[model samples]
Target: MTLEWFKSSYSTADEPACVEVSWRKSSYSTADGPECVEVAPTPSAVHVRDSKNPDGPQLTVAPTAWVGFIRGTTE
Candidate 1:
């Protein structure tokens, strides 16, 4: 499963600092399907969100937590 990375940036009204994130859709998701999930991994955290809604809410977790979750799912 080859994941394509796309960079996105967003800035809040209070913070002038621009945050950049690289998002990639899950390999299990189809091109024309509604059930799509995307993930962005940073140095400190991993962000997860729905591919259909890029501007929607996101779930962020620590890198270690993300690894544990992946291992748990695989096992």
Candidate 2:
């Protein structure tokens, strides 16, 4: 299957240097590098995808699951 990769705008001007961290914004999308992180903010889940590698795997987490992660980091 073919996947459409999206780039982020929040990304830095030097994209090559910031390849791994590239992510597309769900809002304003264009032919650019990652803006920051693709957020599919729903009541239950949060989705993240790679800007450079759209067909690549994604990271999906329940909103509560992510909260747990953050809470863990605080300790």
Leading candidate by TM-score: 1
Model 2: which residue pairs collide?
8-33, 8-34, 8-35, 9-35, 10-35
Per-residue C-alpha lDDT of model 1 across residues 1-75, encoded as one tens digit per residue: 223344335655677766566688888888686688889887778889998787899999998998999999999
Q: What is the lDDT of residue 24 in candidate 1?
A: 83
Clash count in backbone of candidate 2: 5
Q: Model 2, range 1-75, lDDT digits (tens) per residue?
A: 112344455467666432223233645555674444464545556667765556777898988886787689799
In terms of lDDT, model 1 sits at: 0.78
Badly placed stretches (over 4 Å) of model 1 are 1-19
Error of 2 at 69 (Å): 4.4
Question: Number of backbone collisions per candidate, in order?
Answer: 0, 5
* Deviation of model 2 at 52, angstroms: 1.6
Q: After the best TM-score superposition of candidate 2, give how far the Cα of residue 38 lies from its true spot, in angstroms.
A: 1.6
- Alpha carbon lDDT of each predicted model: 0.78, 0.57
